[model samples]
Target: MNRFQAMAQIMAILCEGDRIRKGSQKYKIARKLIAAKIDRMGPEAAYSKAKWNKYELFVEIEELLKAEKAGKILRNYI
Candidate 1:
């Protein structure tokens, strides 16, 4: 199996494990973190490839990664 094969979409993005742009990586404390993939993104007709304004990324990843799957990935992205 490939690396992301076992990881939740949100988990892989979190552990992109590399340096990334500001908005995609870190965020302000008050605002809830979110991850979404844009498709045909350059046009006004573009839409989300991955659920947006939904994942709500968190700080604690270890716990969340173990328990994350199905529709529960969001609540546990911590």
Candidate 2:
């Protein structure tokens, strides 16, 4: 995968790991670090793409977990 995709995957994995460990604060800290890295990279589209990728990845993982929880509820009722 390309740099942006790689970063997204890395961030997604980190987010999932944090969730497993019940580390909400750490996850927020990681997001801030990602934002800072993006800022340090400069205000170009190329740099911004990585930042966006990280945000999207976080959202995707969060949605996945939500869906999983919903599925579990459905399974219990069905």
Candidate 3:
């Protein structure tokens, strides 16, 4: 999934429950995205054998989303 979609999923989880703190939002989203990808790729596909990973990609997105100055929620909005 794209970064926006990934972020959307994380936001949804954030609003879903108090059990999950915002600090773990990235991990939650990464797990969810990986599961979704595995589903789309078919059950035969295994994450262990995958050549790429989402956590690294999410790290890049997090850096981009960091505020350069005064900003809240989203840094760059389309």
Candidate 4:
């Protein structure tokens, strides 16, 4: 699959809410990261026609986990 599709799938799987509640700060953080990556790679139109480079554009699942953990900690402080 292409980067966009892969990204969507990954987000769907990992996005089980943050440390606190559903659709909390972690969800927003994940969405922002996804959006930024998509924007960096151009636009949605390119996702379909763009040549696959062994699925390189998508963020690693572990990274998202780490982001969620960090966000949780930050949320506790804030």
Best by lDDT: 2
- The order by descending TM-score is 4, 3, 2, 1
After superposing candidate 2 on the true structure, give the runs of residues whose Cα lies further than 4 Å from its correct spot: 1-10, 16-23, 42-78
Q: For residues 1-78, could you state the per-residue lDDT of candidate 2 as single tens digits?
A: 444554454456555534524355445444444445444553354345544575564554465456555564322221
Query: Candidate 2: which pairs clash?
Result: none
Clashing pairs in 3: none
- Ranking according to lDDT, highest score first: 2, 4, 3, 1
Please give the CA lDDT of all the candidate structures.
0.31, 0.48, 0.44, 0.47
Identify the runs in model 4 with alpha carbons over 4 angstroms from their true place: 1-7, 16-21, 42-78
Name the best candidate (by TM-score): 4
True-vs-predicted CA distance for residue 31, candidate 3, Å: 1.2
TM-score of each: 0.19, 0.33, 0.33, 0.36
Score candidate 4 by lDDT.
Answer: 0.47
Candidate 4 minimal-lDDT segment of 10 residues: 49-58
Model 2 weakest 10-residue run by lDDT = 69-78
Every candidate's CA RMSD? 11.9, 11.2, 9.2, 8.4
Query: Residue by residue across 1-78, what tens digits does model 1's lDDT show?
Result: 222332244334444544223344233211222222221232121112222422343333323433443336543332
